[model samples]
Target: MIVAPGACRRLKPPYPYGSISISFGETLFNIRTDNFILGLTFLAPLAILFLNILLVFKVRRILFERKMNSSKKQRKSHISLTLTTLAIMIQHLASGAKTVIGIVRPELVPYALIIRHRLIDLGMISVPWIFYISHPMFHEKTARVSSFT
Candidate 1:
């Protein structure tokens, strides 16, 4: 028989787990659909992206410092360094794109619905990263203005 979504234990038929133990929606220890663990799994990529963003910030700081005191040739080198950091940041964002597709295309794979829910949960978990993504944009504008000064 096909089961409905979010069916309670009442409808669950017995399954063999040593003996007949029919586990259903949202159990203790939660071998079935542990949202917390699922959420952490989803945040794994965001955490990596956050680390990448941190590395980008570190690179940006170094470039900014060098731009302040370096010769023209040295300043040109900082541009290449900045470009590399930007490339890494773009790669991180591309990973996020994969996550977004998983969220958006839940119909393509029903099992992925849980993962998609977890990804949506990441919005709460990724609050810190929101600022991380913004910082570089703001820094780039500031760096440009300072260069002209």
Candidate 2:
């Protein structure tokens, strides 16, 4: 079921009287209700940030090891890829942190929302350019067509 953000603030007990009571012979136990969404909301962004960091390191290592043998054109492509990846990672981290902080602290919602929206817009615009610049075939075809013209 879909749960609203406000619904998480006020919790209702599983039972009718707004309290859960358990009895085993003469023993009695009571437990407080917790919002699962709040926990998941906080954890999701952290998980994404961790995965992004791992990806950054792997890409950096691969780029470093391959740099020595690559030609000028290949080196340029690698450098473009490296810069694009770093930019994307920074955007991801900023957005993730904004989300986590916005959820945990409502006071920062407006600022976080603005930052997140701008980051998303920036990514949308830059991704196509990154793909165009990184594709080796695109450059080769352009050069061939340009020579004919």
Candidate 3:
């Protein structure tokens, strides 16, 4: 449907829809109704973000209560895991970026996708490393049950 400031004409049903590929060189007047699904993409992230805030607060509260009773290693590991979970949840928001890819600067679609990919990839790839670095368990050497030398 081509829409002006105050008017819009619904495209007839021979081929009534547009796609992101077709929308690339076109202007905003070249409208489509498929944006609803795109809007749905952000819902998961929004819910996760809300849950993440709650989880962070709960973990902090628990850590505060157990501060003196828990060993330093236990406290450190708990904090490390909570922070990692929060970071990963934040990274999930980038998955929604594709919904707005060509809407605001159509020319930068490629760059936007690249940046989004990098952000998501960096977050996913760093998770194990973050755990390894933050938790001392990964750094510990296991006692040999059988001599391998």
**TM values, all candidates:** 0.37, 0.56, 0.62
Candidate 2 global Cα RMSD: 10.5
The 0-to-1 C-alpha lDDT of every candidate, in the order given, reads 0.52, 0.61, 0.69
Scored against the true structure, residue 121 in model 3 reaches a CA lDDT of: 87
TM-score of candidate 2 to 2 decimals: 0.56
Q: In what order do the candidates fall by TM-score, top score first?
A: 3, 2, 1
Candidate No. with top TM-score: 3
lDDT of 1 by residue, 4-82 (tens): 2353333222323343324345444445544565465457667877876777677678778787687755555455554
Q: Write the per-residue lDDT of candidate 2 for residues 31-149, one digit (tens) a residue.
A: 22234655665566567657766776776777778888767676666666666665665566666677578668967765676677788788777866886777564687443444554
Q: What's model 3's lDDT at 53?
A: 83
The collision pairs in model 1 are none
Candidate 3 stretches greater than 4 Å from native: 1-36, 97-108, 141-149
Across 1-149, the per-residue lDDT of candidate 3 in tens digits comes to 44434434443333237412323334376665456656666566677777888888888998999999998888878888787876687466776565466666666666666677788888888777787788868766688798779
